[model samples]
Target: MSDSAVSTSRALFERASVVTPGGVNSPVRAFNAVGGTPRFIRSAQGAWLTDADGHDYVDLICSWGPMLLGHAHPEVTAAVQAAVGRGTSYGTPTEPEVLLAEEIVGRTPVEQVRFVSSGTEATMSAIRLARGFTGRDVVVKFAGCYHGHVDSLLASAGSGLATFAVPGTPGVPASSTALTLVLPYNDRAAVEQVFAEHGDRIACLITEAAAGNMGVVPPDPGFNGFLAETCRTHGALFVTDEVMTGFRASSRGYWGIDGAQEGWVPDLMTFGKVMGGGFPAAAFGGRAEVMGHLSPQGPVYQAGTLSGNPIATTAGLTTLRLATDEVYDHIGGVAETLKTAAAEALTRAGVPHVVQSAGTMFSVFFTDPAHGPVRNFEDASRTDSTAYAAYFHAMLDAGVYLPPSAYEAWFVSAAHDDRAVQTVLDALPAASQAAAAAQGGAR
Candidate 1:
């Protein structure tokens, strides 16, 4: 994109910053990590995003995994439009929510689900239910496994093994995270140690079905199953936060690839993203036995005025109903091709890198292959961000928009046709070259 093309976005961002912190509703959208004028998107269609300057780029972020069928999917738009005509929200229970809930139950291990407006609400509510059911005060989570900004979940690892976490952000008080335990992702020994030390006091252990926020880190084989078993032994709920992977990793989310075949089920699971189609809808659910402890069924006390908004549920329901096996298969195929092309391009440009994936969701780390796969946040942190920044801008200039930050999954959609795939394939080599140059002769 030309400087002339970026001028409009720059102007819009300036106007946005006057009213919004960091000039964006979401911090990552500010482009602080990549160092550029973040594009102000005016519209999107299929796999392409048109910025205020009218430059169209292949959208690899896929709205952070919600646009599984891609932007402006005809069926989803039409359904949402029809639902809107009936009324946007009733502030009461609705049929669309029930149908969507039933769809989730049929596709995943969750026997019951409660809808919420955002992934943050979904995880926060799940944590509360777990504590209510188990009657415990402590919560455990892995580092780099973002379960939204729930105060307790937003925490940094403490100085010692099994120690209580410190607040990850300023607004979160020490007391909020006082009962939270933070451990390294994929560290089975650390998990064992934490549980052994405070298993009796723990309410639940929550994790991403696969880590995506810290750039795709798949759990070790049998890792999730092990967590489930460990949680069961300790009488703590095992909650997988599938906010980014639900219905995107496969038809049933990552569990379909791992848990169903392994024959172990989580005690609770949180879902968002693709399940919402392109709307702000999320849900948390599990076995009816445990879910019975929530709300009117029992006395956990959770409520939302617009929890089951008809429009959001209709978009979500329509999207899921259209998300057939073919959708996943097509997306997976495209992802594989792009992964190979990127690796080859970077290799040819003499850039050392590693591409890590959890099923179809993946990220290319500008780290050394010598370090092996990025299994944890520490390893993911080793990725060369400066190089990634150069690569990100190069790809953006070349008409393929990747995630602005290095530590994020590059989501793809079924709408990514050969044209879109070719755009990404065509951009890799040059972007790799830019990255190599940024690393001082690919040093």
Candidate 2:
């Protein structure tokens, strides 16, 4: 049984805080947004995380959307074991990189792919390549679309709709964001205005294929296609960051559901998460013409020492091969079931909420239905963080772990069998009640 005391977790957190910046490697994991002692997971397997206190909970985060087959998947583990038997990173190109790259090229619109160690590198490299290919200085992005922590991309929307962005964080200098134009997500007019004014200087307009960072605010129907068309019209590259969605949001990522149907292809796409198969592998790729401009072939250069580590690539390859139709079907059904149940629970508890999804990835907003359909960062900001914190703790107490913040996607895996699903479903009523209680007189 799970304990509310969390005494051991508290102690470990205290110890870790002395060494680590915030007692966690990632800011979100610190529970700063949720207001509680974050559970330190000792291990995970088959849709369950065993915390340091030996309490097991249903894992809804799924390592921020990578473990589609679920934690400690047998086949993936076996592949990695075999790979480790050979050796770890060699700093030299290996067979697994070739195989994994081939798999990526087959699955997406990317014509040629270059491996990287993380989503950040993939985005940073893609942007550089875009600038190089266009010989332009400006880059456009949308609010709520997180494309990793690249210096230029770490920017907030400026004072006006068509203005250049200001630094969103303290460390980012104004000069870093000087050339970035940040606009609202789903606002086509804003996009058109920015391009109309700065199209010649704009190298690329990058956005998440679906905005999962702001709790899965999916691109409006025909939205991504619109971006592609606009960029094409201006000779600017259209770059879609699929770091959170690739493979997790359908076999080929969110692009599979949207771009494939719309018949538009991005000039560049950055991928991570599911492609890494829970490892640190990531990549960026695009049409042959654009990709040819990257390193050895042309001028834009990007390299990583552990870009395609054999163990990581082997694990990613195995996971991708195993991510079949059945895997997606299972995850989608589970997501639908859970989202429906949570809606019902929230309704019963008198807590107005809206649930949004991007393929299999989804998030429940602690906002009213009337003000919903969160189309941009401002709309996403209306999500009641205080209510979410209460709900998060309530769910944690009930043995279903959600994302530490409201502004994040919930993931499910083929391994989320009946037992794990039941645990979450069982927890929803109480969680909704907590949210309702916390949101008193506000909604």
Candidate 3:
């Protein structure tokens, strides 16, 4: 059917369903939680997405935090184009990879790094390296803190898993999660208890530096530092997953918010999103001592055919080079404005809600105000997802593209100028009212 007969997004989705599972490669992209036709984006520029139907929406999701400098950023595009002319992949070491690694080491605490194709690979490799380095089998992760789809890490993940109400997936067997200890986020007592019970057997404990996957639930004051201290005491590696927050939350990512100031650093860190500048690139690195455990230096086996693709590294390197203090300041300012406007809009509509932030990244939870400041998965689960569904579609109709899932972070970019910000601000009040109306199925 043509777009005239049916909405282009719906038609395309129907066609895609014949070939791809759920008509999307990624589950959350299907809009399963928030019911609607997922807009098929044709192109993006600055902070706007032009859909297949020719409607342009202010892009608040920012490709889930990769477009820190915004879609098709001129400098980053030029860098990728230039690198492409040289060639795409070499399957061999490249100067861009070295430069990117140096840039990462310079900005963060990681001393050495290894490139991968996705955040999942970066994290999976980090965990394996942790196991090899510690000679232990157990891994600990926090509830509502997503590290990716690695078998062990997926036990109680957030993001798509949280949105779809899947406690854990099927393909992952019981044995896979046997050694995984899932703890509540921001609960130091829980961490201490877990370490007390399994300290010797624990290889590593990984967490989102600040939990963005569960809607920007930040670590409590001194919580990350405490995790680091406890891990150090127990001889377990502290693995901070910055895949979502790296470079997007701040110049040095979420770690810059507290870890740097408190003089605490994770033994390992995973990075992606903004570092790739929208390309398929990611990395994990840490103290040279721990990283050295990976072969051909050590015994832990981790390899990727496209580990350091030239063009991807060039795009990432250029993006990082351009992500200056001013870029972060601009994004931070945009986040503050939008967060305040969203909270006010929700209040005006008498809709229960809470806005939470971890540096420049944030999310609005459609939950009872009394139950909020969501700290863990249980608290996060209390959000009224149906109300968010209404709010999301209302904003979509009003020329604002938000994260389709309520559990995901809403990203802003340095390119979110006055026009884009105003577009979002204009949409919030009506969306909030839609959420209010949806409370009792009135909408």
Candidate 4:
């Protein structure tokens, strides 16, 4: 199939629109923010995606963060296959889950973990545990720091919802979101003020250890430390939602990077994405006492029939084992290469831009120093998104796939090597030109 042969995807999408909401299982897949038909992906390997139209593009979105080792890695595929032969869903305890949990704890050394089905489930359960342990009702989150679509956490979501400009999903009751206190990212004083007012009623203050949902916004110096101390002083649990940054950010993830340096650790941390190796597995863990508040051990209740599904566990274990020190170094190198290339391209085009990054995750914002640095969601909202959309389509047309929205981070996997880097670089000139042309259209 070629892009011209629209029979398969177009026909499928047309039929799907009537049955599924917006013709996509996920809203971002509709490409509404990017203003074009989405290339339906059929298969992926290494750093490339083959679309249903038979077009091949070097993938930078990396399946929204899980493909840190790239799609269909041999070791992961083999492990999943072996587990499948044993059985898909045991609905019982499995050794792989234990091994995966051991690997996570061994790496982070912060707490005991419980595996769940998705990042949403992990955050949902973690919030419930925090509430149960603290005997409180309020949860604090930052604007533009998405922790998945759990009803309470979507007050100021950043990813797909931000991309599409959907105010809030229609189904969630307004009262359900009333308890969520949304604040600006990287504002310590604001956080302190909120804690001063509502700390007693607040069960937890959750944030992306590094905010990837809003284009790789790293913590300001001493920011994570302030959060840790504030939470402790106020008797609120500090929960780091590392679903996108978990293993992909570093061997131990963003918390290990910032928390260790600051001599602080969150009371609870959630993990997903790269840890699952593209499978639907996630976990939340922290101090044993805090985690103990969850289920059979305490009053908070969370259970899933597929909580530790064998196949997902096997995939997770294989990916975690493969992400050795060398793998991290390789991913870091690739990220640097991409960042340098993008910066050079933007500079040469005389485009005012800011490249925000952490480990292998990065995003390019079409704004200058006059914006006073994108410290929070309000600053991030000032980016030239229409320019980004044009750049995205140009890159896609030139055989490189970036995240469709300006708000989302572009991920670099260990599998993206010299060839992938060169491919993106080759596409940059045209993408830059397109971005410059579209700059005035940004709102």
C-alpha TM-scores of all predictions: 0.98, 0.98, 0.96, 0.95
- How many clashing pairs per prediction, in order? 0, 0, 0, 0
- The regions of model 2 sitting more than 4 angstroms off are 1-4, 440-443
In model 4, the Cα lDDT at residue 72 comes to: 89
What are the RMSDs of all candidates, in order?
1.4, 1.4, 3.5, 3.5
In model 1, the clashing pairs are none
Could you give candidate 3's per-residue lDDT for residues 167-187 as a string of tens digits? 378898767887788877888
Runs of candidate 3 exceeding 4 Å displacement: 1-6, 157-167, 440-443
Superposition error at 313 for model 3 (Å): 0.4
lDDT of 1: 0.92
Candidate 3 clashes between residue pairs 3 or more apart in a chain or in different chains: none
| 3 versus 4: better lDDT goes to | 3
Q: Write the per-residue lDDT of candidate 2 for residues 1-443, one digit (tens) a residue.
A: 24456778988999999999999998999999988788988999999998888888999999999999999999999999999999997888899999999999999988899999999999999999999999999999988888888899999988998889999999999999999999989999999999999999999999999999989999889999999999999999999999898888999998999999989999999999888889998999999999999888899888888888898899899999999999999999999999999999999999978998889989999888897588988888888888998999999989999999989999999999999999999999999999988994231
In angstroms, the error of model 3 at 102 is 0.5
Model 3: how far residue 351 lies from native, Å: 0.7
lDDT on C-alpha atoms for all candidate structures? 0.92, 0.92, 0.89, 0.85
| TM-score between model 2 and native | 0.98
Model 1 misplaced stretches (Cα beyond 4 Å): 440-443
lDDT of 1 by residue, 29-67 (tens): 999988989999999999999999889999999999999
Error of 2 at 174 (Å): 0.9
Clashes of 2: 0
Which prediction has more favorable TM-score, 1 or 4?
Answer: 1
